[model samples]
Target: MAKNNTRVRWVSIGLTALIIIAGIITAFLQAQADIEAVNTKADAIVKTSEVMKIEGCLPSRANGNNITRIDTRLDSMQREQRTAFKEILRRLPNE
Candidate 1:
């Protein structure tokens, strides 16, 4: 009976240790998964921000003014080209 009790005690202690180790490993795995999820979310946010920047969602006043100025210059240049072409056509001799 004494030998049986000792053996049972050791078995119980070994099972308890195994359970503790399993719990620790489970916790570590869960933490790793959580960290990966957070990193994925962070990467997604960064990509979204980059896309928004490229799409001009975060335009500054200075940039807006510069774009407007560029557009006005382009329009002026087009008008000048059209006028020059008309003048050249008028100067040409008719067949």
Candidate 2:
């Protein structure tokens, strides 16, 4: 009888440990998903801000001599594309 009770106790402890482990794993996965979602949103916001900046500088982009203009829009991160475009434009031949 004592041996049977010991076996049952061990089984209950094993089950409790299993439940705890499963909860930890679930929490870890949920945290990872939340991080990925935040990262995706951040990337989208940065991309949108960059596009708006380029659009805002459209007057300077009217000229056809603007390949560097496109590259500059992407390179400045959060600065004015015109600033970089002007520098890059000077290096190119007149078009």
Q: Which candidate gets the maximum TM-score versus the true structure?
A: 1
Give the range of the ten consecutive residues with the poorest summed lDDT in model 1.
Answer: 56-65
Tell me model 1's lDDT, rounded to 2 decimals. Answer: 0.92
Misplaced by over 4 Å in model 2 are 59-95
Query: How close is each model in CA RMSD to the real structure?
Result: 13.3, 12.2
**Candidate 1 local lDDT, 1-95, one digit each (tens):** 99999999999999999999999999999999999999999999999989988776446554764677778999999999999999999999999
Cα deviation of 23 in candidate 1 (Å)?
Answer: 0.3
* lDDT, residue 72, candidate 2: 79
The C-alpha TM-scores of every prediction are 0.60, 0.58
lDDT of 2 by residue, 39-70 (tens): 99999999999998989778665776567876
Root-mean-square deviation of Cα positions for candidate 2 versus the true structure, in angstroms: 12.2
Against the true structure, candidate 2 reaches a TM-score of: 0.58
Best by lDDT: 1
lDDT of 1 at 2: 100
- Residue 6 lDDT, candidate 2, scale 0-100: 100
